[model samples]
Target: MIRKWAMRAVIAYFLFGTAMYVYLFFIADTAIPQMYKGTSADPATFLNARELMLSEEYSNIRNLLFFLNKPYQWLFYYLILLFGISAAFERWAKKTSKWFSLQTLIYLFWLSLASFIVTFPFAYTSYLFSKTYQISTQVFSSWMRDQLIDFWVGYATMAVVVLVIYMMMRKYKKRWWLAVWVLSIPFSIFMMFIQPVVIDPLYNDFYPLQNKQLETKILSLADEADIPAEHVYEVDMSTKTNALNAYVTGVGSNSRIVLWDTTLERLDDEEVLFIMAHEMGHYVEKHIYKGIAGYILLTFAGLWITAKLMDLWVNKRGKIWKVEGTANISSLPAFLLITSVLLFAASPLTNWVSRYQETRADQYALEMTEDPAAGVRTFQDLTRAGLSQVNPPYLVKIFRYGHPTMLERINMAEEFKQQVSEE
Candidate 1:
């Protein structure tokens, strides 16, 4: 009893201490100045940062929405942890005479549904805020449908993961984490390969970009970058979002360059080319493949850590929480919570790797297009369209910003111009 209490106290201490550090040190006010200190360049004409600055009202609203959304998200997750939802669900699931997989599936379905229900108001409020701010064009009905689609996707994915997890646990008994980590490799790749074709289309319509002139320029860039594609696609995101985005998706035959309609419609041709070039650079450099390799290593480490930590946690609290074992359906939430905490703690390291890849892609865009000014302008356009913070604190950059900040991107473009000039 004493040991159990002691372990719980330690965990509680670690969890809260880490949370406070991450929030205050990583997520608190941290945006550096737009132009680097000691740099005497007018980055607007030189680097394109000045035009993207939002009005005070828009900046505050965007920042406010972001700040509000984070806590709302954490509240739901915390409620699940504070309440004995996982153990209770497990006990209830055991009462059912269904197959173990069926029981797990049912429990997961309810969990997903309940999570969506609890979070919907907060989610809708976010959408309302976006709409009010002219950032989201999605109608309530379309948004609800997207939410429903999201639930299905999440439910299906969870069910599959849970089934595989317990199956491995039952079979291996002890080395299940190793097995699951191995399984995550192919599953992650498969997910990426299918997302563009199978999953993404459910949320938005995609058509080949219709501007023949721009299409030719993009294909020319792709050719120069040696990216093979059927064609670039334009997703009708403007139907639902005033925010702009574009990306390279999938791998191999499934690979595609998908531009949000908002992106195509909002930016000038040079800016659009820069955006496409950046995304295309992902393929030219094969970041996805490299990311998968990195992900495999990360997963292996994370799962090992999780298994060790969860073993200690459950050893002390299993009886109290009423979770029978790691194999129990009720333990899923605990597993999720543990992983969530671990992932949060690991955010800075992971975010840094992502930012590095993004920066590389940015560099590639500058080189491939030979258009540093346009590349800088592209980010400026994105900042206005997406309401992205121009210069988030370095700590926020370490934890939350997967891509380089607008300021950093502009700085990169400035540096690129100097490099080209020396040539």
Candidate 2:
């Protein structure tokens, strides 16, 4: 009987997985193309106003995503409630009910605390595991405290907002998706306005670039490439791991370059110039807006399909586990699961586009710097400084890495150097 029940459970999980894909593909094959058609309805009249027109399309896409996310969020919560109940039952069945009961007692105590009403000890345990493996730089206590604070802030903010939205939708009984889309547009605009200014500062300290010589060199490269930026800032990355990174943050007047302090401390002036030039290429090429535009185009279909699939999942099997989509609170786990599964599903499409984008940036970096050797040194130093795996398996890098592997990058830089030397 136990074995038979296990077989049934396995079958159910497989069916759920299949239903998710079929729903996504069916919706994506229809809704996305229609949205794109809507996107092209009124082409920008002037070249300069094209950005404005595209921005409108982007807003529409985000609005659609807001509606899509509601049902997806519901399914996500249902899945988590199912998992929690299953875990509790499994413990009870193993004659470990006493220990499980103790855990629940502790959770109840924590949940009752007014200040720290967020009880997500199991989620905190995952970060602890990461720290144990040296993958996460945060200490266990610090990680736990950060998680608790984050959970409370996010939970409180989202609870009030979601409740208001739900009540409004329920009371009016108009197309809730349409209402959600309307509400989401302004929220999206607010995010666009404040993410670089307000949100990034909450997580990391930012300071103006202090090294005059290095800063001057970077500025010169940007000037050469015709990338306009008023200032560069150094970010305190030493507080975390030794990974090297740099990016152009913000849009329009808020735009500025941010470099990880690790990059400055570890890389020489020339290599740093090359890295800056690469980042400047991103600006000159307008890759940031381009990236946002790409996501805006895709997210409409992605979220709608996600919502439809989650609804199907809830209808099919959620009740067996007493998991109601609308009432459950632990929805993030389901979102994470579906996201992971979809990432795997869309790996080929995403990977191809990513590799192409990286290649284009690399080409621009080579052209902008006029020194392929600097580019090579920059790549090598970054790899060494970060202790990167030099030759990851192709499948691993293809799916996991956004950038090319260390060896692939080094070889590309070397090829550019050879071609330049011959010229």
Candidate 3:
């Protein structure tokens, strides 16, 4: 009976995803708003006919993948539980280790390996699509190496998270969710603090901005913004892709303004400064700290809800699933399945907050640089370099867009230009 239900759910999910993709790709109106039809903000104003077509195709494909990935992940976990694979993993782990933590690690390694294998196709397909679109410059061997690194890093991180959660469960019992939530606050911050110095360098080399003259200008901008930034670092991204990006990352002493080498290579000094100012905006506005706070609050609520759901599910179906209770090591997939659904459901809220912050940064950049022309041109160049859609489908904008759409950004810059002219 459970197998039959799983099959039906999978079919329904696939069909619904297919229908949504078809509608968005073929039927949705992805054109720039009528208000900008002949204005400079029109995508056609910057992108040629071929570029526009490619951007739409690329964006649609990306959206399709984004929509499908989460549900597929949920399905994977569901199948693992239904087939008793997770329970079997538990048995194997117990046989291998008398210690609970060691047994947990053994079980997790097998589970993580299976997940890695299952998800590799999605990652490869994304790479293939990017390669086809001339967006990826990476060779197959380099890409595979990166994939291996990602898998191990992911497994290690998951190991820590699962160990902590399971340890809390063993000690706190029904109150484990509260304990895990408390610990997660510092864990999240530590990850952010170390990510710039520890995790990031494993994939690419980072060095102080080689262009001293450009770095001086950026530092001057940072000073004006009251940001305590001392150095700007550039990463070697040219070997991987043609995409251009810049960002603010880390917290406190680890805080950094990082520019992709592609951004420096492709953009002029004034444009790069505007981008720097935008990143500085993030620091000055304290978006990172605020983001952490928001995450902590959301997780507090989510974990509480998850505990309730886990209890309800385990009490009702734990026997048939070959699970003893919520505290069982075999219940990790079930826990993940619940959290994944909650995360997906919460995406719109998170994305909206992110977009709001991005918009403020754009505004801050314009005000600080007082170079609206450079801002507009920089955005246009970004769209061209990345093959991004100026205006994406509404649902895509809600679920996937952390930054404002290209059309909105260009319009903001143009408005800034107009306001300065009046002044």
Candidate 4:
């Protein structure tokens, strides 16, 4: 009777969470659009507005790429339901004369390998689309090499995660979730600190900014904002893609600003300065630290929720699924499937948190630079260079976008101009 009640509670928990998320998504989708949808700062007001005009061929290609991935997302779920990568890996690992940890290592290795193989078609299709649109300039050999590197990186990361999970399971079976959540904080920070120095360099070359004049200007801007001003890095992205981007990465001593060569080549000095100021704004606002804090909180919450859901699910379906426990290894795909479902259902809410931070960063950038016109021009450059949809459909914005739409950002710049004029 108690188990039955627990099951009912889990179901209720999921349903209530889903309903709440849907309601919030609806609210954001409806309310936020009216603020900027047809405003004067709408990208339509700017020439080369990506959303306003496109050749039919380009439009068809863009729309096809946009919608093609929706169904492909289910490939992960379907593979779990059908071929069962986790089950196969677990069963195969157990066939060896290995200890439990060894079995887990082997299981993880195979799972990662299987994941890469299973998803390569989707990756290839996406790559093809990027190539078609002149976004990706990478040669096939280079792309394949990157793919292999990515596989190993994923395998290493997951190995640590799975090993820690099982270690906690063995050490503190009753409340291992709490322990895992605690450990994740430091691990996440360590990743953030090392990512710029360690992980990113594995794929791209990064050199100190060669443009002495622009570097001086950027350092001046950073100094004004009380940020670290040395060591601006330029990534050799033109060798890989035509997309323009700049970002602040790492934390503390490892923090660095990296700009793509394409961005430097494509945008003029004023526009580039506006973009750099935006990146600086992220640091000045302590967004990196805030992001870590958010991750820490989400870590505990996600692990706790997963623990309950996994326990309930395994209890109900363990025998049928040929899985003994949460740490059984065969149960991994089920865990992944459940967590993916939870995340997918909750994406709008999560994305809203990211959008809020991005919007804050935009406002801060405007204030720090005091160049509303330049800010507006930066977005215009962004649209043409990145081919970003000016106003993505509401559903896409709610679920997929981590930043506010182009129109929303341009509107922010316009509002800044108005406020400054009034002052």
Query: Which candidate's TM-score is highest?
Result: 3
Clashing pairs in 3: none
Error of 4 at 230 (Å): 1.3
Q: Rank the candidates by lDDT, best first.
A: 3, 4, 1, 2
Ten contiguous residues minimizing lDDT sum, candidate 1: 40-49
Question: In model 2, which runs have C-alpha deviations exceeding 4 angstroms?
Answer: 1-79, 83-189, 321-340
* Per-prediction TM-score to the true structure, in the order listed: 0.86, 0.65, 0.99, 0.85
Please list all clashing residue pairs in model 4, or write none if there are none: none
Once superposed on the true structure, which residue ranges of model 3 sit more than 4 Å away at CA? none
Q: 1 or 2, which is superior by lDDT?
A: 1
Lowest lDDT sum, 10 consecutive residues, model 4, at: 23-32
Candidate number of the best lDDT: 3
Q: Model 2 over residues 1-423: C-alpha lDDT tens digits?
A: 434544555566556555544443333221222322322111221113544333333323332332343334434334434545433333333343345334333332232242232224334544544344333576566565666557555554444444444444445443443454455555654665676787677667898899987788887777877877567899987766556889777777777789988889888887888888777777777776776666554545554554455556655655664535522322224433454456566665677676667777887888877777788777766644443444443444555567776556666777787788898
lDDT of 4 at 310: 82
| lDDT-better candidate, 2 vs 3 | 3
Candidate 4 lDDT over residue span 3-34, tens digit each: 45445545655565455445433432322255
User: Could you list the CA RMSD of all candidates, in the order they appear?
Assistant: 4.4, 14.9, 0.9, 6.0
lDDT of 1 at 278: 90
> Pairing residues by index, what is the TM-score of model 1?
0.86
